[model samples]
Each structure stands twice: as structure tokens, then as C-alpha cells.
Target: MELRIGNKFRLGRKIGSGAFGEIYLGTDVQSNEDVAIKFESVKTVHPQLAYESRIYRVLQSGNGIPNMKWYGKFSLKTVLMLADQMINRLEFIHSKSFLHRDIKPDNFLMSKAGKSDFGLARKYRDSSSYRHIPYRENKSLTGTPAYASLNTHLGIEQSRRDDVESLGYILMYFLKGSLPWKGLKAGNKKQKYDKISEKKVSTSIETLCEGHPIEFATYIHYCRSLRFDDKPDYAYLKRLFRDLFIREGFQFDFVFDWTVLKLPAITMPKPSTLCKCTLLILSTF
Candidate 1:
């Protein structure tokens, strides 16, 4: 079945698809502006749908995240129904008292302009990316293996940390151009996970992200720290990333505080500086 693509939204092309749904570029019928459309599906749920729904619904969206727009829930095609499932996941989880268990880059998208690099784009906006996932889409596990959290891996109940791990993975993938597990392949889940958990083995991540500018570079660093703990939580990750941001970012051009901050300044040579210079000359003589 085909979704109605209106003149208001001209579907330019198919950009990407997730496990739950497909994302499409649509234009505003009245204003003729670009918008994204996600198709979801609804099926009689007996199992995994609960997890997917729990994560989506429970996920607390603040900051710049786009609030979900739930359309009329209806049953649709299962073929390419990944998108359909995700909407159901989003709705169900939020209804329950849980945040999104999985928050990866694949789960979100941005306007074409915001999709560009931070330097190229007017601004870097991630939290606001649109999620055009399908209804009742999530089935398998509630999370992706690559970006899933330690709690998720250990088969713990869903929590905010799952989203944190996924978000960290997305941030790294976008800024650095690859997941920590981008290239390596494994015969089994255990082997693949060992590679991610021991990030020191992933040399490609360092090499590729090496020369990026400070802002993006800092983002990658934050991502590294996030993936370390097995049960990484968003609040913990947020605090860690926040401290790192203050210390490393351009927005933190702090002047050296001589006493409290305990930093030295070489503004003008003081009497001490002159005496030191003199001592050096005398010692050499």
C-alpha cells in the first residue's frame, strides 16, 4: 500500500530506513516546505512490541528533541514495516513510566540542512531530529546490539541508559563518520560485543576522528567515555559530557585565575620575572 504523498509535501527521494519504519521527505502542502514522513504498522501484539513501545513512550524528550506526533493508529503492511513498529514502540513506552531504552542515530533524522556537518550547517541540532518510525514496529530485542547499553546487554529492565548508549553511538557516528564497530565483523554476538566493549582495539575510530576540529573532536571524546560503562545512564553520561564540554569547548575561554584557578599569566614581566632573568644571566656567567 502507498502512503498519500500530497502536493503540499513533494517526496524528493527515499533517504533512509530503520528497523521499524521508513523515512520520507515531504513538503508542506500549504507552505511548500520540506517535512519528513514516517510510515508505521500495527499488529496484534503478544511479545516484543511491549519493549519497543515502552522505550518510545518512556523516553523523556526535552532539550531540543522533537515531540512525537502520533497519527491515527491503524494496522498496515508488515512488508517493510519496521517503521510502523517503531511508532507503536514510541507510543507504548511513553505511556508506561520509562524512557526510551534505545536512542541511536538510526532512530532519528534531521532536515537536510541540519544533516550537514556542524561547521557547514548554520547550527548542529541533533536532539530535534525527527523520528518517522512505524507503529508496533519494534520486535526482536528492544535495542540494537551495537549501541545498546550494558544494562541492555545484561538483560536488565529498560532504563534511560539504553538511550544514552545509543545517543553516544549516534553522536560518534555522525561526528567521526563510523561506529566503533563500523568495519569489524564477527561470527557471533559475543565476539562482536567483545570488540565494542574493548574500544582500545578499535584503532580506526581514533585515526578517522584525529584531525577533526575541536568541537566535533570533543563530541567523539564524549562518546568514547559513554561507551565505557556497561550500564551507562543518561544522567551520568550527561554530567560527564557536560564537564568535558566546559573544559574543552570554545565556549569556555576562561582567563587564568591566579589564585583560585591556580594558573600563571605572562602578561608583562613582573619583578619576579626580571629577577629570574637576571639570575639566569648570572648563573651562565
Candidate 2:
């Protein structure tokens, strides 16, 4: 099925779907460029799509973030490059006084370009306010069970540290393809989450990163050590990955794991092409 949005986008085949909405591969009719279009029902759900659109608007000027090509939009090239770019994105989010409560592989949509789902994001406080947001317990689990921080499992209110810690898990998952708690079993969803949370708190970083890069362990340790109110040194975290890349003799090219597969060749747009923002002109359905 095909649906046209305004004069700019022509939605094509469905690419993805989730609890929030469906994603389609779209085309910019004017520019003839490929884009991803997400459609969510406003009747059945909260306005998460609109909220994510606002976040993209705030991030339009930031580096390493997916460009807001149109409303409710944004991929990375390599795993290292992806990690580096995401850290910068998180840094920008924190700078704006928000905590990305959900950080997982699914939320991080990777392609030639990158964008994040901010459905679970919440503002901790005003950016200008220096007062610390008190940590509270008995809060509901907010992020994916596998990638969530131990603090998240313990019912502690999340902060910037939690986001960084979740990123550490995501990076490890990318490298290893599976986490230690991937197959833990329980009678129900709550019990399964509890088991996964227990494993996260109990498992040593060394064991988690065993036979893999040591930098992964180090990154996780640093993120876990941060205090609830402490601001993360994004530069320090980025440097860890940079040093790892140097040691491995890899360049920050656009080539990724998927690029190695027998798939259609990707023709990357010029840097200038990305700078051209397409203003949103939504259609009345």
C-alpha cells in the first residue's frame, strides 16, 4: 500500500512496526530522496510521535544527531562511529535537561542516517536550575530489561548516568551480538525482568566483557560509578572508544556490519545534501 504525505513524501512499503506505530520507507517526491516515515494513531495512544518531533526540532542544530529531514524523523555507518555519534546525541539531550529513559538497540535505528525514538524520554529539571533532582525508589522499570541499568531495576529515579550506563550495555550488545541475560526464564514478564535485573547487578564487568574488548568493561565500570547527580564527562567516554579504534586499526568510515553483507549498495549523499532541511508540510488525511 502507498500513502502520500503533502507534496514532499510518498510513503511506500512498511519497514517496521511496534507498540507505538508503523514505519514506512518513504520518498521525497521533490528531491527524489529515500526517507523513513513513521505513522502513529493519535486515537489509541499518547502523542509520542509529536513529542519525538519536538525533540528532533531541538536537535536539528546538534552534531552527530540524525537530521530532522521532516517531522517525526532520522542512522549511523559503523559500530564505533555509531557509538561515538550516539554519545554526542546523549550529551545534547542531557544539555537540554532531559533523560532518555529508554536506551536500547531497537530505539537506536541505524541506517546510512541515524535517529532515536524518544517516546520514553522525560525532563528531569530545567537546564538553568542547579538544584539536584532527588532520587526516588519504587519507580516502575522504564527501559528494556536487557539494556537497563541496575539503578533502573532498583526503582531509583534515572539521571544522566543511567543513560550512559544503558549505552554501555548497547555497545556491548553490538560487539557480542547477545548479552549474558538474553535467555533468562521466568513464569511471567515481571519475574523475567527481575531475573534479568538480578543478573545485571550480580555479574562482574570482567565476566561480561570476557573474550571481548577490555574497553567495553572499562566503559561500563565508569558509567556505573557515576553518582546520581553527577554530570558525565562525555569527552572521557568518547576517548575510550577512540583509543580502542586506534588500537584495532579501524577508520571511522561509513562501512558497517550490514555493509559487509550481500545487500544493495548504498550511495551516500554529500555532506551538503544533509545540511538541506526539508520543512514539514503535513497532509490532512
Candidate 3:
């Protein structure tokens, strides 16, 4: 039987699943538009969708963030453009006093430049006083290990720096097509996770960004230099890529490598000073 939601959406087949629950492709009855609806099992110990839904509500007006209904490519130009968008999104999230604990390629929807999956989203500041959260240690690792910061592996409390660092990893991953610790071997899940952490800690930025532009290393270095409570130099970091983009003579055309290959692609418009309401849920579950 076809399942219907809210008397407005008709659920289609299940498209994917994750730690929380299943995601179904559905259609809005009123508009006949497809929407990705996430469902969490009521019996689950850690219910996330409801919390994520709240975060979406707070973040709705932010640029590059996925709208409530919503929910990539491979190239330097692609990476640079993505870097700008991702940083912009992170800045907005931070400005709203929340941390997008999970920062990875899988969490981002390519065409929309939307960051989805806020199951691990956290508030880093006090709602009343606007005070930054105190630093702590020995917190369990959150987010994908491959793209996690070394501080995260060390069980330290994560902050904006960690998110920015994870973005650095993501950019390098895009350029290199895979991270160094992607397929580490171990006896079990815990062991494998430890190996990933070890690899991340041991891999120097120089070695990691070797053969890539110096700006990549600069980005990683800057991220690592930030203290837990330190505000990231978002403008400086963005300028690094924007300058590189200009130096490399890449156009702001949003023509990614995949687009050149004639693969399925979405043409993103040139960003304006004001945030645009360009929400679409194209993320995999």
C-alpha cells in the first residue's frame, strides 16, 4: 500500500538508510514535487529526525543550507566553488550558534550546495547569555572518521575549527579522489576507526597536500591553528580559494568537470550578496 504523510505528501519507495532510519522519496500532493522524507523508528534510542527538523527551521534563512524539505563532482574548480559554498554554510551555522558536527562529502548535496544530515548538530553557545561553550575533552568521536579532525579523534570537544578542518579534508579528498586513511585495515570497527585516527594524526599537511597548490596546505594549516573558541578567519580562508580561482583563470560559470563530460548536472546561479531561497533535497539517505 502507498503510504501518505501529512495528507500532503505521498511516500514512494525507500531510497536509502543510515544510522538513524530510512529515507523515502515522496511527492507533495499539492505541488506534485518530489521530496525526501526521513523517518526515524519510534523505538530507537537516539531519535534524530525531530531534532534535525528543528535545526532546519532555525537555519531556513541561511544560504547554502538545505531547506526543510530537502534534503558531487570531482575537480579543482569544482572543489574551489564547493569550498566557498561549504564555508559560507558553516559560517551561517556558526553565526546561529550551532555546530554541524558531521562535515563530509556524503553529508553534502552536490548541485544544491546544501549541507544535510544534522543528526549530530550541536549548539555551541548559550541561548540566553550568548556565551561560548567551555572546552572539554574525552568526548566520543562523532561524524565520519575519514573526514574528522585530529582533535575529534583525540576526544576533545569539537568547535568551529573542527568543522573547518573537516572541510579542508573534504577539499583534499576532492582533489585526490580519496583520502589516505579511507581503506585502513583492522580487526573490528573500533580498531578500524582507531587506524583512521592514527593515519589522520600522522599524516602531515605537507604530505597530505603534496603536489597540490600551496593554498590547500595553507587552508589546512589555518584550520589547525585555530583554538577551540577561536573564530575562523572565514574571509581570509575564502579569499585563498577565490584568489586561486582567479589566478587559475577559472570562470564563475559553475561549469564543473562533470558538466563538461555531459553528465547529469545542475547549473548553480551566480551567488548574490543577499541569500537566495534555493532549497532542494537531493541528498542520498
Candidate 4:
């Protein structure tokens, strides 16, 4: 269905969706430029568009942050460019005292190099007291199980460390077609989570990042080494990939692999070797 928002932006076909809303390819009537429109229902169990709108306001001036002209809306070695942009984006988010609890491939938009899907975002520090949220345990798992941090799987409260760690997994996923924990069998959901956690715990950084650049492993190691309340070295992480991009003699022309045709296929691990887990169900706040 074609709809116009306030007669300013014309919503076209839906290009993406999430648990809370749908996104459409839109065109700005004034500029005639293409844009994306995010729509949320009034009756959603957990309304987050308003909250996300607030986040967009807070992040409006930050680097790599998505532009939000109205309340409704929300790269690569392309790979290096994307990674660098995301770290810069996350760094700005952490600076604002909010934790983007959900970090996954789907939440990131490739065309704009911006972060989206803020439904699980939470304040890690009290606004008045400025005190960090106390570390806790036995918490329900948050975010996608596949990209979640090891500590997250163990039920530890997530902080900046968790977000950075999840990014490490994302980087590796981009480099390699899949993660090692892709294909494990279990009788039930509980058992499946246990297996995933175990695989993450048992898989060494070196093994996990084998055949890839050492910087990837180093990034993961640094993230895992942080204390629950420690501030992540965002600069260092970004530098890790930036340096790799430089060493590989890649130019910052902004042209990505996907933009080119006749590229070699990415080798994915056999189905029997890697596993994909289902998303963890979220509870309403």
C-alpha cells in the first residue's frame, strides 16, 4: 500500500521489518531524495518508536548517526568501512549512558551505516546519581543468541563490554561467512542455550578467528577482558580494523564488494559444522 506521512514523505514498498515495526522505502517530496520510513503500531505491546525517536534526538549530532528529520524514521571494506562506522556509532551511544542491548546483523542498515532497532536499549547509568547500574546475574538472555557475548549467555548483566564483544562476533561473521557455533543439536531451548554458551566458552579466540586477521582475535580478547563496569576502548577497536584495512592496501573509495559484480563466493562452513540458533523471546517492560 502507498501512503504519505503528513503529505511530506511518500512511503513506498516495505524494505525491512522488526518485532516492533515495519520500514518502507520512502521519497522526500521536498528534496526528491530517497529515504526510509519506520512505522510502529499504537498498540504494540512495548512501544519503542517514541523512545527510539528520543535516541535519535540524542544522537542527531553524533558522527555516523542516522538522520531523523521526523519522529517516524531511522559500507564495507567495505567491511572495514562498515566496522569503523559501527564502532564510532556505538561509541557515541555508550557516551550517552545507554546500552543497545540488541546488536545483530538485522539491526544494522547497510545503505546508511547507522544503528537501528532501539527497543532493547536501556540506561546503564542513573541520570541523577550518575552511578553505573550494579552488576547482576541470572538475568534473562537478551539479544540474538548467535551474536550475544559469552557473559551475556551466562546470564551476566550486559554493559558496554557486552556490546563491544558482540561487535567482535559481528566482524568475524562478516569476514567468515558463519560462526563456529552455528550447528549444535539439543533436545529443547534450554539445552540449546547451554550448548551455545558452552561452545562460546570453549572456542578459543585463536581458533575462532583462524585464517582471519589476528586483529579480529585481538578485538575479541580485549572485549572479553573488560570488567563489567569498565569502559571499552572504542578508539583501539576501531584502529584495529582500520590498521588492517591499511595493511591490506585497500582504498577508502567507499566502494563495497557487493557493489561490484563477478566477486568470488564466500566460503561458508558446512551445515554439519556450524549452527544457527533461534532468536530469544523478549518480554514486555
Top candidate on TM-score is 3
Worst 10 residues of 1 by lDDT: 276-285
Tens digits of per-residue lDDT for model 2, 29-146: 6677777666454332454666776877787666665555555111112456667777887888888788889886555544333335678888877667656688899999997888
**Residue pairs with backbone atoms closer than 3 Å in model 3 (clashes):** 70-281, 71-281
Per-residue lDDT of candidate 1, residues 235-277 (tens digit):
4334444454444331222221111112334232222211100
Q: Which one wins on lDDT?
A: 3
Ranking by TM-score: 3, 4, 2, 1
Mind giving the per-residue lDDT tens digits that candidate 4 earns over 103-161?
86666654334676788999999877779999999999988888999999989999999
Model 4 misplaced stretches (Cα beyond 4 Å)? 1-76, 261-285
Per-model tally of clashing residue pairs:
38, 2, 2, 6
TM-score of each: 0.33, 0.64, 0.67, 0.65
Where does candidate 4 clash, by residue pair? 76-79, 182-274, 182-275, 182-276, 183-274, 183-275
CA-only RMSD, every prediction = 23.8, 13.3, 13.3, 14.1
Off by over 4 Å in 3: 1-73, 261-285
RMSD of 3: 13.3
